[model samples]
Target: MNIASRPTAATPPPNALITEAVQLIEEAGPLDDAAAMREAMARRTDLPGRIALRAQLLGQRLGLQHELARARQWAPWIGLGLVLAIVLAGLGLAGSVVGGAERRINIMAALVSLLGLHLLTLLAWLLGLLLPLRAPRLSFGWLWMTLTARVAGGRQGQAPVLMRAATRLLARARLLPWALGLVSHGIWTLSFLVVLAALLFALAFHRYTLNWETTILDPQFFLQAVQWLGRLPAVFGFATPDAGVVLAPGGMADAAGQRSWALWLTGCIVVYGLLPRMLLLLLSVAMWQWRRRGLQPALDAPCHRRLAARFEALAPRAIVDADPGAEHPPAPARPLDTGDALLAVGFELPPDVAWPPAGLPADARALRIDGSAEARRTLLDTAAQLRPRALLLACRAAASPDRGTERLLRELLAHCGDCGLWLLAEDGGAALPETGVQRWRDWLRDCGLERIAVHARLGDALAGG
Candidate 1:
């Protein structure tokens, strides 16, 4: 498969697009530096016009890894629905059973079977929200992601770069557990409704009495509880038994009473079990939508930052050269000593300039320092350890000498006492202004360092020295 081929004009779904992009980035290898990768992406002429550059990159990669695209699109929903159907069937059959030809359901037992675990799970979910606890692993969302990872062979091998990218995107969207919970709760509501339907079907073909018996509770307690529970269902025109009916010693065995009891049970399931879960499902859906709209890949992440810088460098921008100075005299040609290690520090060189430019001696080692504080610290530490015989500091000639530059020079001088200091001026394809060159020279002299030699390139300095 042509992994580098651009995707056709038709755009896939967003999730699919993202998945593809991640695959492409991984296929391209380590993106610690994205300059070459971006270049490769830009050269792809066949990428769809409608998709953004980021999406296009992914799609191209997806096109390459075609073998891994055989996920069962309908499996998650079908599996969940089948499980709900099984639970409903089991519960309905269990509730329909009778003993000694009495054919009566223990009201308390039936209610507990229907609502006990649901109520407990709801309470636990609520507590999870209030308390500092990790997300539940048993959630539908967790299961779905795990299943997807397994199907995609994500866990069996090293995690690809795109997988990490996808994770970051989801995290930024802030819809991990909540989105999963929504699916789970929606399934729970459906399961309860299915059970209710099954119960109604069972009632059509068979006759059963509903009764409550408790050793610890009096008849009045049961009557009051029934009245309280029946209030909501009563408003919807479902029948509720009065004091005489609740207090009856033989229980409600007549057809009308049985009908009333069935309506009351269905009402309780709808109002308590199904209704709240459905509401939670809706809430999660809304939250996921709200958060998804704000989804954007974090630009400051290292890989993304490098990609952004690369794109920025590619854009056309006018170069304003403040230095028009006569070029410094070329240093006399001399081969670099075999034992001297070359420590080269670049102070914002142009993107095109390669560090430790190709001609250095075999023994030389190089480090490139950018604007990051941490990188500067690393540079200092590395320099301390290497203690090279020569120190080559390279900076753009167009950049004005600032106090930060002064401080850096002071620190390096202090650390690498009396070493050969070469200030390599990179003109960035333009001549440096005479004033800029003198400014840097004057600054170095003020630091009590007079023997410093200036060169336009490291190769020239190495050749001269």
Candidate 2:
């Protein structure tokens, strides 16, 4: 993580081993400044005392991805679980019962049955919500807060341990709402499904229950339930009910009497209509939680760690100044501050999904680059106008020149040094043109250019042509 050793005007080395080393450093992830430096360190062969640095860094990334994915996957379930608990609590408090008259389950009994479920759901959601706060390896919030603290606190001294711990706590606290939201959502969905299933089962079982007084049998009880669902919206003023059409549940009657359709209708409407709206409400709340709390702020958001690595590769000397000590008077109070040691990895745009340029280009910049020599010049000129120290060039794999493209390569290589160049071939199929491959290699060697890092769009090859 020594930023002071970077070269000021470095070029990619000709050796494949050296080039691979540099690319690894620049491409390392975790999206932090200090992490970027470690990635950069992976390029240095002469650094002693650390043998497994590369493996350790790679392992860290793999582990983080696993942890993050797991966390994300659990988010929805946690939300749903909380929602279910709330629903159960409501039912218990309301003393809601299931089934028709004469065959109905006791309201108190239903509530008692749901109490165990409520407690378990509560425990599960609370554990999930709090796990991020306690887990050290998954402390993204801590990392971001510390980065912000460093930026705000100045770079003159090392960060205090207390401050670091405090930031971690702050990060954990920040994520609590998101976790709770997810739990709430999970609980609601669970409860809704449970109620819907129970109601369906009850309706099915009760449809043919014989009344001693009634001789008639109804065949469309399930169908009537569906119709009740259609009528539910009208219950809430969605549509006016026709006058004199009020439907009310009637108790069982004597044999040869009309069947009780109202009872069946009530269960169906409540299950299909009311439950769905309640579930939607929970989903909306969860979405709001996601938008407000889970999403990282723009400044505190993660950036590509590779940018710093690429910068270090193109101009290592620019970053590493042997004079960090030389600038200040030697004093007990004064200490060299690395100040977060973050680097902007190369600029990473969202990946381009299209291939063959389709009708328009996949990327406007790419279209301009592969269009003509003048277009390339125009792009370079525009970039120069912006005074950017580096430019990331994305070219189609198929568009990469072959034997016939030697002249293009020579031309591109000749002018690429004006600003640090990052030539990105979007497709893995893009090969060095055959005639120019050896020449390009030699030229790269002569100019000390390192390996060109390849970024393949996974599944892009399989996309519709």
Candidate 3:
């Protein structure tokens, strides 16, 4: 059973991996870019928080929320409609066994009619899970999604992103089978139950005789088929017709024989049809819940990554100061109660770029940033706690600047008394391409950090050169 509709895909990526406890990423509406800039610079949340909120706002601004809400509202109805249709289909199959004018039930024909379609669909569902398969859009679950999409104004704006993100998310978590199977089995379970009810009603209320009919098969074959099909049902306490009833000519059976045949058919439907479908429905529910506990969006998707980068430009401190100051912002004399004399953090750097850049002071604390939410949070927390005298944020010179980087710069700058951007390269790093240096210079200026030194080497940055 669905406890709720789908949760947000852009929840704050976990400190380690995504977990259910993560809060819903807030959806936002249109706002002035300037206002967003001021808000971001003043904001205290981490990178993931900022990105999630910004992406949500951007989506709403583009009118995704209305469409998304409509889709979600219709999701359950589509699912329920499929279930209702299954029940009607099964009832129709059961009714096919009832003779309009004759007073006999063709036992074999009735059995095939009730179970044939169910078995075929069940087999197809199994094959889908066994192979390296994506859940087809035509399947009941996806049909619901598609129909709901149409009801919600079709796949426009961020709607497609949500759809692709959901597939990628569930498929990556290996829950596609469990999810699709849940719906599949639910449909079959209800259908089989309906068929069973109809068969019981006809059996109890009508006086029709029950017997097998075959044009080419031997009497021995009918005897064997009944015995084989009835073994398991008999084990479950169902009455099975004996050879006297099965081998009789013209499919004629006495009252007792007819009774036996009736129970046998009911037992077959219950044991093979209803029981298996219900059990599978339960299993799919359990597996889906188990596999999907901590499910989060796979960030590798270009759409989700793009949403995250949407606010890369409007950092909280991307706000500029009214008056200019000296080129170098002076360092704090020292930490008041406690903190590193110098805190050097390595932002996403290549493996070749040496970590904890050499020549840190005795009281310096060195940390490496691997680009995970946890790593970023740890650095931010440490900086806030230590109140470091100087923060030397070392980034690679070759790395292209993005809004995320600028936001990170602003947040890091806010925590420490003095903060500077250090462009790491081997010797003669500062003398590299003029374009690269100037680009970074522009990036820093845009972050309102122009006065902060952009050092080319460890020594020069430390020495205030």
Candidate 4:
């Protein structure tokens, strides 16, 4: 199905399937037991009653994972607020140190300290992405999750696990990292804006001269760099001092020159530092939203596949033999002295196997039992009512004999005495696993059934009977 057409977390109904699934997960405690989860979903009549049960369930799971993450980090905004405060305080402190000095502030040094550090951070982030594996410590989001996990321990601690599992399930979606990058860069962008605001405020009230002093690098190089930086903002009609004025720098010659230098510095910070960060933030957000729109769980995963099968099995259908062999002709019906003599039943039969083999008496009845509570109850009730003289229970060899099978057998045996148990193996039993056959034998033996028959083919079993 096209996941993009489906409702997302951004736009959902009041009683969304995902919200319901999150409640179920919370009530489930540890989120184990796939059967119980399926049962819970099956019981919900409010859910969209449709053929896409698997897709709906998966979408709900995604929603539940998101809810868990949000709950675990209950106050993420608090962390963001703290970060903003720290940025403002740091910028304010730097501004104080710059404006407090009697000597002129080195505009080049201030720009490098502010914008260069951010550029280096951006480069580090890019390099980390290129590496196949990254340390957890390198991830700002991971650190945030870790800190929040510690605060909300135990049951709440499952958020990280859920998040990791969701990421793996939706790895092809590629939304998580982009979403995280958007937030990280957004914070940086905001920080720069706050720093710019502080710088502007300092420039307005305090009279500070702008100078450039570097021993190793020639002044010409610094002048050229400033001129280059000013060019972008100059396009927007901001003042870009001439090469002569930039090169003649010890300190600004006059108040007008100092004002012009301030404008140039402000323009450079806005153009170089703020604008690039803002663009990256917007790009990350766009990518994140695009990926989120297409996010879908891996429906082919074993757990989801089994759940889908379970849902499909709930649909009622006629009990008919799926596989019939052409090798054996129908045996002539042998009249039985007793009425309602033999009833053949197949339990969780594979699609390839036939039911009620041709060799059975013409009067013999056939039934197929699926893996459902209602089906099991119906089978038991039908057996009690019919009370066939001899019963034949057939099961596929590929199906592992579980406690549910044993329970059904016990119940059936209680209703019909002296029943014949048949294990129908695929491919004339040649491809049947020895261990699977032995396992069934062992289970039957434990149930005190001594005459269990293993048949490679339905025709052979019927002919033998």
Candidate 5:
């Protein structure tokens, strides 16, 4: 008889076979390959149910593969868009300068052009620094680039792939506060010089207007000129009555002939010159406030709350509920002896918490390899190195236990013992060893590891000095 036409059982069907397959894998039980298969098949005696289950699993796999491919395609484009934006902004700034100088492109105009160029560069750098998080398009762009790299390897044409990879670097904005601050300080310092130049220009122009008799170089004249200039309207548009420091107007003049020219010049100078400086100072002050308030009890409470929310979304867990505010007992730290080679296993940790302590031993390195096939290969390669005191393993725990994590642990354990391996975990769960801890230890012993240390606390000697 054909399996598809097999008679149904007298008992009513309780659950779909696909659901049963997933449930069987999830519920903890003894490991017997043949028995497990028999149990799974027994859940759905009908051939059609078993066939439907297989089809469902196949479809899920296909969907995941398609997502990976789409992510790959998007990654490089994101990176390119960022880099292009930088180049375009630079060019646009140059265009604005050329466009500003309608006819009499004198020394003063040249200086103004230089100042505009400098501001444009600063703007580009800030945009680049904040790109990762601030630029909405970058995340998918990075995802695509990474996927492309995984598929194409070194064989993928270098330009498009590499460019996207470069753009994706914009997303890591945490480092921006310091790096951008240093650059900003430099830019603002240069800006101070620019403002001083503008002030001096205003003073000289005033001196020339009020007293053509007195020498332009006279210090007394310069002082008086500046004093009068400062008294003028803080807001742009009202021109000095006697001063000949006219900024030529462009476009159709609406407020009569000469009046429109004065207003336009004042508007341009205020916007392009004074406004940028004011904005820079404000941003610098705000950055200072954020850093200062970071330590305050009021600020710390809110920041901690925000941080907890972020952690919950990234890696959901029940165990991550420990008070960030409350001081806990420090974990014991043990330094590893230096060897010829060290294997770093793990993913990069978020910046708020410290890892790798002060100084990791030269012979010992660790990588945060979570649930990834590439991560597994990375672990196995280090094991193959076969040097004494070779392998170091570490994991940042999720806030909660889930099926995906449990599968990762199983895979990690299956290939762990080759050289000395150190497994570190933030908290015990699927990311840590669940079963066969002794078996793994035995394998390590056989591979010449003197001793294997296990600890639950994150702030331990194994992490660093």
Candidate 6:
């Protein structure tokens, strides 16, 4: 990535990001002071390079290189799984429309059957992106991460850090949506292609009588619908069935009428289904590529700060006499180490979600944040005083993770040694069209909550670290 020569927003490559995350983990481990000093002094490259090289050296020494390699392969594997799933789904939807080749085909039913789930999923993705939730799970990205951790057996080693680091880097770059969007649109494109192919084959071989049968509605509704839906198809050479065929109650239409209906159906799927998805796939690809190049690290993060300090301590100095009159640079500050206490806070949670968590030690303290500045200040002050071993902040699942929420989390996190985010999912709360658990995880990852213990259940969130 050549971070030194690049612009300020320079992004490390995926491998470098993984290495840097490993560096953070190593720095947080048992501090062997003399060993660290010797390692730091031996490096003479740019800070980013030195940091990356340090992780590589540590990984080999710790026998974690295999874990890193496995972690790097996860994204591509899960992505392939996503593509295969989508293709089968498209084929299944199309097959449902064509199976049991009877004489009659309901145009309305066919259209809805073919595109219902696809359109619904598309809408959900749009909402997730628009709300700026940065939904890493809106597609299969979260599943990819989870599968990676489990499959790679990352519960103990560098694999866990690798997954978290990847998510954080992608989220921090604001690339999660675009990256997932590209996968989504690409898969959808392939699915619709399958649909188009299936439809073409059915139309070529199987002849079905096309008719619209309504119970109580006026016939005019059916006539107008045909014209409205077929307008785009007509612009391309596909013909809409005439009023006689459109209003026909049974399969009374001639062969020509049947052919027009088939063409109209095929055209609608192409114009409405295939072309739009294809265009969106192109759009997603462009956006992802454009944003992919600048995945900057959170250099100001406490973990990085501590490591940078250690590295600087052994930094080479030019042979010059110390200036007695010059002011000395202050030593870097160390983050507060955790004590034995745990603090559980519910941030803007509704009345139902239990506060103080059910089970805690006698020394543990709990509070609910009411979104007031005073309430937040009290919480931070309390954290500073308590120096809790672990802090679990429970928040509403359905609520949009707005900027204010992120800011509050960032501030509270600094006061505690380790943090867990409990996304409180109430029984009746409004949710993303998909699951809310993953959506919140996506937001947390973007917040740079490394190796975050994201829990749906309050118990798990408050469990011993």
Q: What's the TM-score of each model vs. the native?
A: 0.54, 0.29, 0.62, 0.56, 0.26, 0.60
Q: Which residue window of length 10 is worst by lDDT in model 5?
A: 293-302
**Cα lDDT computed for each candidate against the true fold:** 0.57, 0.35, 0.65, 0.58, 0.38, 0.67
lDDT of 3 by residue, 1-465 (tens): 010121333453222121111111222333344444345435734444544444444445545556567667877888898889888888788787874468678889889888887777777777777888667544566666666656666644445545554555567678877777787778878888788888888888898878777779887888898999999999999999998888877767798888898999999999988898789889988987687754664433333333323333333233223234534343224335445467888887655456665577766788888767788889889888877778888875545566556556667766666677777542213334334355577756655566567866677678772
Better of 4 and 5 by lDDT: 4
**How many steric overlaps does candidate 3 have?**
4
What does candidate 4's lDDT look like per residue over 51-114, in tens digits?
1343345445555445555644664764576466649765864575366658477877777777
| Ranking, lDDT, top scorer first | 6, 3, 4, 1, 5, 2
- lDDT tens digits by residue: candidate 6, 1-465: 111233343435754565656655655674344553466458634465555556656656665677767766766787788779888887887777776557467778888888776787777777877886656364554565677677775567667766666667777777766766776777778888888898789878987766667689888987898899999989989999888878666747788988888998898888888888788788878887788776766554445534544554345332123334543333223246768788878787655445765555567677887777898889889988887778887775534555566566666666676788776444323222224466556655554554456776655666634
Compute the lDDT for candidate 1.
0.57
Question: Between prediction 4 and prediction 6, which has the larger lDDT?
Answer: 6
Using TM-score as the yardstick, the better of models 2 and 4 is: 4
In model 2, what lDDT does residue 412 have? Answer: 34
Name the regions of candidate 6 deviating beyond 4 angstroms: 1-12, 23-37, 58-65, 72-77, 101-103, 134-138, 141-145, 154-160, 213-220, 319-465
Tens-digit lDDT track of model 1 for 316-368: 33222323452333322332332346676765665556676666667766777
Model 2 Cα lDDT, one tens digit per residue, 1-465 = 222222322221112122222233434433343563465465654322111244335434534223333434543454444455556655443334443455544322433354444445445544655575442322222233344334433454222222333333324336433433333434455554565456546655554332212136342442343345447544543332121122212323332221223243333335443455455447546655554432221111112223322332333222122234333222112122212111111222223323323332332233233345575466545543343222234332222223223333333333332212222332323333333233323433333343222233322211211
Runs with alpha carbons beyond 4 Å of true place in candidate 1: 1-36, 40-68, 72-102, 127-133, 152-168, 218-220, 250-254, 310-465
lDDT of 5 by residue, 1-465 (tens): 111123533221112222223223323442233333343344643333433333234324333324334445654564455445534553443334333434222223433554555556556655655664343222222333444555443344333333232332222223233323433433344444444445344433432111122225554453355335434432444543222323223222233423433333344445555566457656755764554322111112222223222232332122223344543222212224323555545443333334553345655555555445686577656544433243445433322323333333334333333222333333222234333233334333333333334333323324431
Q: What is the number of backbone collisions in each predicted candidate, taken in the order shown?
A: 10, 45, 4, 1, 24, 0
Pairs in clash, predicted candidate 6 = none
Question: Model 5, 235: alpha-carbon shift in Å?
Answer: 4.1
Candidate 2 positional error at 159, Å: 20
